[model samples]
Target: MADDPRPAARRRRPLRAATIGTYALLTALALVYVFPFVVSLANSFKTDEDAANNPVSLIPQSFTTAAYQQLFQTDLPLWLGNTVVVTVLVTAGRVLFDSMAGYALSRLPFRGRNAVYAGLVAVMAVPGVVLLIPKFLVIKEFGMYDTYAGMVIPMLADAAGVFIMRNFFESVSPSIEEAAKIDGAGVFRRFWSVVLPMSRSALITLFILSFQASWNELPQMIISTQSPSLFTLTKGTAQLASGALSAGSQFPVKLAAATLMTIPVAVLFFVFQRRIMNTTAGGTKE
Candidate 1:
């Protein structure tokens, strides 16, 4: 090394350059992704004319809360309530149902278990847009159309959530369950008390994802219900964007709605983001 210090230095130089380059590229990408959100937030505080004229600007010509006030004057409260109800129901249902299905698939011995899992994977691979018509037909045929059940039931369990939970469950040691069984705990008791308590990280990950998906969901909401009373934030915001709520560009109002709609999901993600990454790594290792 003393004799060839130049060679080692040269080797590290390229790596250092590469690392710097990578960081620069990532920084640029992060800015690109965040720019629109920054503009939207800024424009939300702007008057409609300012927002329309300077949509890409991060600084408003003059700031105001008129857009938010206007939004509240509309059916925003009803939309917020509906969104909260549907999102809570959907999130709770997904956590319970997805975990149960995952546990069953991972631990229970049943005929065609592999086949069922294969079907689940297949379902995940299918594009959601392709299922829209079928989902609508099923909801209508079941007489759940325009009802809360139509909005919440079909989304209660998703293939991806089941897949995540099953993988996490498989990574868990069976000896824990075995010990519970030896203590005279039945299947349901072991699942609820033993297995579930240990699955906190995975459950939180599922909860965050389920909450975000249901909160932002649009296509399903569109197909599920037409009643204004059942309209969630997504539908209401879409209406606002389409000029159903106001005339002219209404950029401030639309962006204001978008900004508000993004807050909950953004907060949830930021709070639980670390756990999500850890769960993903854990799942990968298993």
Candidate 2:
């Protein structure tokens, strides 16, 4: 008997429709998400009047480098340097400490481990804003206020990052570490060579997250430091928008600063996006 093609065609029709609709929806969402950045980049090259006049437009009517020139003349360079220093230290510290804590929580069976895990989960639920005042008091009491130490130290470890690493470590095979131990490898050696290297995806995820968090952090930076020399990109940019560097609304200058601020994080995410996706899809298995 000859097979009929009608049923096959019928099955494909809805599938094709669904695929097209899905792509259309996703494309629309992508445009919506990308529109603001495009507009901001365009405005950064425009004069204040042009930006104000065509705020929603993605093209500059009159191009000018004045905003960037004016921005460079201010404390932005110093702010960038400070942001870089704090971000690198904070990211590095979080990656190291969070991974260690996570490994312990996942692999090291100890007294009150459950309690510690529960505490971390609870901490994650608590709003960071609620801790601002308490953090300030502690920093002040420690005499670390207005110092880079104050800025970098408070953000060194995050409960969420620890939780992420712990979950990733738990998913990995226990036998890997067990074998390393049987080979006479010490705890630290096993963790560094066997466990850590296998958890590359998780580590990169933590790095991207920690870098972005520290880079964009505003409240902690504000609470920790009052010195202009210690201003991060977020704080400095806020000041610029609020008329610290110039009188009235310097729209172009503010937009230019904001545009520049988004670049690093964007680049980081794109560079590691495949790694993130792969880990998310096929998480490490025991």
Query: What is the model-wide C-alpha lDDT for candidate 1?
Result: 0.91
Question: In every candidate, how many clashes are there?
Answer: 0, 0
Instruction: State residue 110's C-alpha deviation in candidate 2, in Å.
Output: 1.2
lDDT of 1 by residue, 1-286 (tens): 3596889999999999999999999999999999999988999999888888878888888979999999899899999999999999999999999999999999899999999999999999999999999999999999999999999999999999999999888887777778879989998898899888778889999999899999999999999999999899999999989888657899988999999999999999888877772453332222
Please give each candidate's TM-score: 0.92, 0.96
lDDT string, candidate 2, 1-286, tens digits: 9999999999999999999999999999999999988888888999888887879887788889999999999899899999999999999999999999999999888999999999999999999999999999999999999999899999999999999999988888778677879989987898898988888888989999999999999999989999888998999999988888666568889999999999999999998998872354323565
Task: For model 2, give the 10-residue run with minimal summed lDDT.
Answer: 277-286
Runs off by more than 4 Å, candidate 1: 1-15, 277-286
**Model 2 has how many clashing residue pairs?**
0
Candidate 1 lowest-lDDT run of ten: 277-286
